[model samples]
Target: MQRILEALGWRQGSFVKPETVAKLIGDIDSTFTISANNLLVVASQSCDVASSQEEYIELSIVRPLSAEAFNKQYSHNRHPRILHIEANSNSSDEKVILELKAHEKIQIKKSLLEEFKPDSSINFLEGNLNQYIDWLAGRYKRPALPTKFDQLIASSDKKGKRKKIAKRANEYLTGIYVDIYPNRDIKDEETYSVNLLGIASNDQSIASATDALNEYADILKDAGMDVSVPKVGTEFKISVGTLRQYQRINFDYLSYEENNPIPPDTGI
Candidate 1:
């Protein structure tokens, strides 16, 4: 039952917010009014009788967001709203019943009363409610797992094996930081350097990072920006001396070999 509920997107610790309920119902029909905890769905076409004839569907939240509330509510009394359908100019009376329970798993039951007329168009209302249930199910469905990546990682987790799976997982889980700088000393306005940090020192990881950076640079070039292939270990110097003493520059503090430098032409 727990697995079934989780598959339907209902996490154990999460609660369905009232706003979500309102949004779901609004998606189905924007005219449906939410008064307190009850959803008022008017199933009639008559404007005059629309106010009095409304199907009241009760919605409540449990700790796990299951169908427990529906079971408890319907166990006592069933008659909540009488659905009136106009079929071929004939008015027919039908009762709206909603039942939700978890036997082996959570199940949904929504239908009209047994007294449905032969030519009644109550199926339209039933279809709408069924669609709403489908939307609700999707709303609570669980997130999909990264199956292929997980499998690849798990395959390396055998005994005496160098836990390559864990390493692979960590590679994807880690974040990369990039510092972009323009080559201020260079006469070429298109010259720029992008320093990527937090990448694994392994050759394969470095190659992959370089390939990704090249692709990004290509995208920028395609967008009318002048960017060149990044060269590793490029050096630049910054002058930190006063305007009067240009020769007394502090090359140690402003060296691009130690720190990332931004080019003066890039505006940033």
Candidate 2:
């Protein structure tokens, strides 16, 4: 989990800075409620460096749910839920809340098995399931953009500058999956697979996307993170295709619903 947060650009701290916490939720006499199960880490906030846009960083921490509680709430449903808590009375001022259980990883794996059915005659190699899980969790949480990147994008409404910043942002990797399979007899017998995915522009080629991802990994390494660039391959194509199809179906359904009128109900 520390590795995951570090990869997402969070710096671990014994406590979230007093000033930072105050800035986020306004002044309070009591300190943030930290527990043994959860600790806070600061995320570098970025905004238009030159503009009057308020520049403030965000702090995030994860609290793990117990297996018993998790199973009782989500075992049958198998879907992670999110709730946003509004700090002030204003609806716009809301804080993100993410919760995950011990069983979620296994449940996610089971869902993947049902989706792919890898063992049925097709010799499909499983990618890093952990990476997929991380991606699933992280995709909902927005990462803070680099200040410079944000500045570049906001400096002008020019298409070229926007495209350039978009390209750069696309290369920032969000999730890393490490696959582990156990051996029956030997404790040391295991195979490791790592998979990473990044946000990229629609027009970017696979090669360009891969290069951008590697560059981001290099940046993480420079920051003293124990990170490595993995060879980009076709492991995620199946999921991509599935998502695209699902999106298309949803689009069509929404379009139909929008265009068609509701039939008047007859008393049955």
Candidate 3:
């Protein structure tokens, strides 16, 4: 009999061939068709891959993603279902993005996986493999925005400065973390104070983010609560000493998201 805990060529973040992926997938109508530039990515955890206790492995459909698509298109859609594997992560010259479907995974029996090992498994570069795993786990545990807060975000595109504010915040700043006091047990029509914090990568972006946060307060003015935003600055300011005061707003709450669509991309 074959050894139960035999070694395999694949690891947690391994990238294998299309044929290998097809063998693993039992029978699901997935887009398993890999192109010349595309390859199969292993999503199973490294520990799991290493341990003999685990019986199965999971994989994700992947395709080559140009830097243009990474920056302009898919990058804007930061939803958990969407993930991009950077080109620098591997020795390969091209980048790839995961094509995750609703739990319809390219699963295979661990014993069967031992049948063959990939020629060479490509994993993410540096600490990115760990980061990818963390992201996968984080998606399930991610907190939801208050219903009222989501409503406020959805309403930002109604007109005037709100559009610019929403565009700047969502498109440029990327996130507006808020701490709304008394958010718990809020009754209908009840008012609550909001403290805003915008997150950005650089000083110039931070300045713009601060302005976006202030402009967002204008939208929140009629959103049923007192809104306070930090002023434009070269550095991020925080309340005396409480990190709890600045919770990052979920990207799902952004109006530009398909999740909270203002007008479902009318194909103009």
Tens-digit lDDT track for model 3 on 1-268?
1243235557766776667655645543455553434566677876777676777777666665555555422332344555554524345665444433324346756666666665363556656676566546644545454555556545653565654565546555654566776755367777778877665646767766767777778777866668765543322554534445555543333333335433221100
TM-score of each: 0.18, 0.23, 0.70
Q: Which regions in candidate 2 have their CA more than 4 angstroms from the true location?
A: 1-37, 41-54, 67-242, 248-268
Candidate 1 local lDDT, 1-268, one digit each (tens):
3223323333211222334434444334323233334322222122322222323222322111223333321221111111111111123464333332211121111122111112222222444344333323432332221222122223443241222222332332122222334323333234334433233335445555455445544443443335545322111211223111111111011222223452111000
**What are the runs in model 1 whose C-alpha is more than 4 Å off?**
1-198, 231-268
Question: Could you give me the TM-score of model 3 versus the true structure?
Answer: 0.70
Residue-level lDDT tens digits of model 2 in 139-182: 34322222222232234333443234323533332122221111
Higher-lDDT candidate of 2 and 3: 3
Per the 3 Å backbone cut-off, how many clashing residue pairs does candidate 2 have?
2
Model 3 alpha-carbon miss at residue 75, Å: 3.5
Predicted structure with the largest TM-score when compared to the true one? 3
lDDT of each: 0.28, 0.29, 0.55
Cα error, candidate 3, residue 226 (Å): 1.6
